[model samples]
Target: MDAQLIAFTGVSAGLVAMPGADFTVVVRNALVSRRAGIACALGIGAGLLVHVALAVVGITAVLAAVPALFRALQVVGGVYVLYLGVQTLRQPHSPVGNPQGGPTARPLRQGFVTNALNPKVSVTFVSVLPQFVPAGAPALPRTLLLALIMVAVALVWFQVVALLVDRLGRWLRRPRVARGVTAVTGAALTVFGSALLAGPLRALLRAL
Candidate 1:
């Protein structure tokens, strides 16, 4: 593989490995149940496919061109994430190692929505993926191929995280530890959402 491709792989892997909203979500679900964790990971992959589809179809460009529309999406996504954080914080701690294995539907939907609504994902695909595409290559196919690679990398990383959490279920299930995990994850989500909103909020203030 060429240097660019290698760089792309390294970058994508690094990004996937880094703890972020998706990581937090997956870990949270894993603490609940192995099934929930797997479901959440798959949901995130599915959501990424949606982003790839949009980027391939040129919606990314449209969003970039329309500042107001992009800002509106940012605001909505930010609010949704913030709400999720608050909801997580309010959930009472339960016995560790005794996962509820929540219905598959909830985590799946939550993962999909959380990932799909993230503008950063869209921006990354639109702006970064193209850099690795070879000149004269069919842009659409190349972008799709790159998206698949990213999705694969993300799935593997998330699954590993799920497995680790499952193995540590005993420790994670302790009341104090579980509460601490929940609180930290909740705070991280809130901070992430607030950071996302800051840009749009500032722009709106300037406009006013």
Candidate 2:
């Protein structure tokens, strides 16, 4: 990749890695166990792997080629983000959000899946990975390398978010604070949805 593209990807990844729901999930796991935190980090990285892999194989290209498929995905993604916004408005339980898996191998698995299945993530992976890759780069290894870079960026930033928040999680969980937190999170989700909805406007701008 060119230097500009690399820089763009770095900045974009940094923006995405900013303190948000992904950070919260990793922080939750870390407060539970350091190992779990690392595992969860890897899992979140793995979810990006899926996105990068799909981009390498031209999956999003096919989707983008078909207007219907692409628009349908955008609609679905927008609706899902709206749903997440609503869900975030609910009261968060204590650290043990779910006790059913209390004795499982590690909480990393579910945490990872939560991110992996997240519609916003799917939309992002399909959207952003292809941009930095350029048109003529070697497919597999280059894509994998970019994926690793994205993951590395995510791991460093988010693990720090986890570590820093661990010190504050107790205080942040207070009833009023948590509600405020959730409300802000909901607004962020709405912004993501709006961004996805506005994506088509990019095509019009390019056409002009």
- For lDDT, the strongest prediction is 1
Tens digits of lDDT, candidate 1, 1-208: 6787778888899978887778888887888888888898889989899888889899988887888888888888788778778878888475434555758898788788778888878888888899889999888888887888888999898888988898888888788888998888788888878877998999999999
Q: Model 1, poorest ten-residue lDDT window?
A: 92-101
- List, residue by residue over 1-208, the lDDT tens digit for candidate 2: 6794578577667666665555655655554445565566767767666666666676756765686566556666555555555555453433423212233344456445545544455456556655666668765766566666776788677666656654565665566765566566567766655665576557556768
Q: List residue ranges in candidate 1 displaced over 4 A.
A: 1-3, 92-97
TM-score of each: 0.93, 0.61
Assess the local accuracy of residue 172 in candidate 1 as a C-alpha lDDT between 0 and 100. 84
Clashes of 1: 1
Clash pairs detected, candidate 1 = 96-173
lDDT of each: 0.83, 0.59
Score candidate 1 by lDDT.
0.83
RMSD of each: 1.7, 6.0
lDDT score for residue 191 of model 2: 67
